[model samples]
Target: MKLPPLKTLPVFEAVARTLSFSAAAEELHVTQSAVSHRIRQLEDDLGESLFDRHGRRVALTEEGERYLEAIAPALAQIERASQQLRGQSDTRLRLAVPSSLAVRWLIPRLPHLQRRHPDLDLTLEMLADMPVMSERLADAFITIRYRQRGYVSTPLYVERLFAVCSRQYWMQMRESLEDAGLREKGSGRSIRPEWLSRFTLLSAASVFEKPGEDWRRWFQAAETEMPPTARVQQFSHMLLAQEAARHHQGIALSNDYMLDTASDPELVRLRTHEFRTGDEFHFACKQSRAKEPGILHLSRWLERQAEASGWR
Candidate 1:
């Protein structure tokens, strides 16, 4: 019963999953040379090529895809079993964060975090489709609530959301107002807060307790009310709402972390006001594990990330 080298399995898995030798090395905390060596060894042992590399790009060979399908489930099961055995040890943490934050900010920074703490292992559970809280969901959570029965929380930052829309939408709306004789024909002026009352609002349903709550708060911050006849289109996630805004579907609420103005020149932030949601995003862990080495390390690292992002 000759099995492939046990050490090479993880290296193979990381490379197959990411399809990049450099990314797999970063994920596994090994040098790219080590990753290449492992891949060569694995291929030698298996008597098959796993990847088809074209210059700097790589794709899994047909054999590699089939191998991945077989091993991926086994790896996942092994990880789950290991976590169950490890309990609440800080070294292996299952951290949950809001989906929007995870996508826009956290995911991109993960490699750096891994680089900082090579010995630590992290599994991120995104909170878009999942319920926010439970004793068994994750070892730590990034959340809006500060107090939970058995958890101690640390604040990350208060959320300040601003209205954003497609530049085309703004221009068209301005042109319509001009046609109606509501403004000087060619003046480049900021849109008034009341103008939003007539615009379609793109709503992210995940963040609101009830429909229009966010818009209500935002409108009040601008010294106006969300008009009764205001049109609202709801998306299950904030990213979806932002995408809708980019497509000129409607105006959506967003902030700096999520809005890459340079890449998304089509999306423009409304100049009138930004609404600060007083609810601070908190990093929380069970009271018994709050002082655990892994939890403390992760918490402090998160603080640095938020500060560096200038959102604190």
Candidate 2:
């Protein structure tokens, strides 16, 4: 049996699904006239009118409804098959991740990920911690705490906050204390809680002001108060603030999940106190795409990586 023009089927499907010639035309990037012409041509080929039209309104006929139900899945399958033949089925995965996490964590582990999935094309986009609901933004997003409604979210790790500074800076503090004979004579090194105000506080744009993750929260957890006049330098993102802390510019509040423990010898955590904000990293995507092999495979790999690194 000969098939009708292959191109018209997509146009027919678009129109039947939308029930609007203009809408189909907009989606197909063509004119309303083109959509009408295609539908009319498709009807002529099948010897059946697929829609009932009045003015700007339209509805699928009984035959159109049946045809849509039949062909939609077939078209999707064809598209997937074509992608597979072209080596793109499960080959490309686009991910949006927090900038800090991308830099300090994901990028470092990416080589291992690439080795494990050599054929997979991974595109990473750095996004700040914000609510992104549109699926068009990314195939999946890795974020902290926030999950867009209607998306399937897989937990990665709950986070802990720490005060971090460069070894050089910590040594300087110790030296200054020793010169003044204020250093406690022992291996124990703990800065006084009030000393936090003496050092500049470097902060990320969003997390620093977040209710449960901010300077106020950390100080509250420590049973202290941030000095009202404490010198604070705010960066547009956490990665920037972290870099500043690495250079001994100031003390930065670091998220455990976003820290590269093995790599940053310059930075040291001031284990004087710790804070947990109850926020966690999550991998989220549209529910319809959650069970796709690519998504599931990557999610499992991420879970393992996080667990192995004690990130979870």
Candidate 2 per-residue lDDT, tens place, 1-312, comes to: 889878899999788767889989999999989988888888999998899989889998898887776687577558767887887665577789888778778888899988997776889977865655454456778877446676888888887777888998888766766776766655476776667767788877666554223667778888988888888887766667778988989888887755665777788887567787777788887786777777777788898998988876
Top model number, lDDT: 1
Clashing pairs in 2: none
> What shift in Å separates residue 137 of candidate 2 from its native position after superposition?
2.0
What TM-scores do the predictions have? 0.64, 0.69
Candidate 1, superposed: residue stretches over 4 Å from native: 1-90, 129-135, 178-189
Off by over 4 Å in 2: 1-78, 81-89, 179-182, 210-213
Measured on C-alpha atoms, candidate 1 has an lDDT of: 0.83
Quantify all predictions' global Cα lDDT against the true fold: 0.83, 0.78
Query: Lowest lDDT 10-mer window, candidate 1?
Result: 128-137
Model 2: how large is the Cα RMSD against the reference?
Answer: 8.2
Instruction: State the local distance difference test value for candidate 2.
Output: 0.78
**Deviation in angstroms for 289 in model 1?**
2.5
Lowest lDDT 10-residue stretch of candidate 2: 205-214
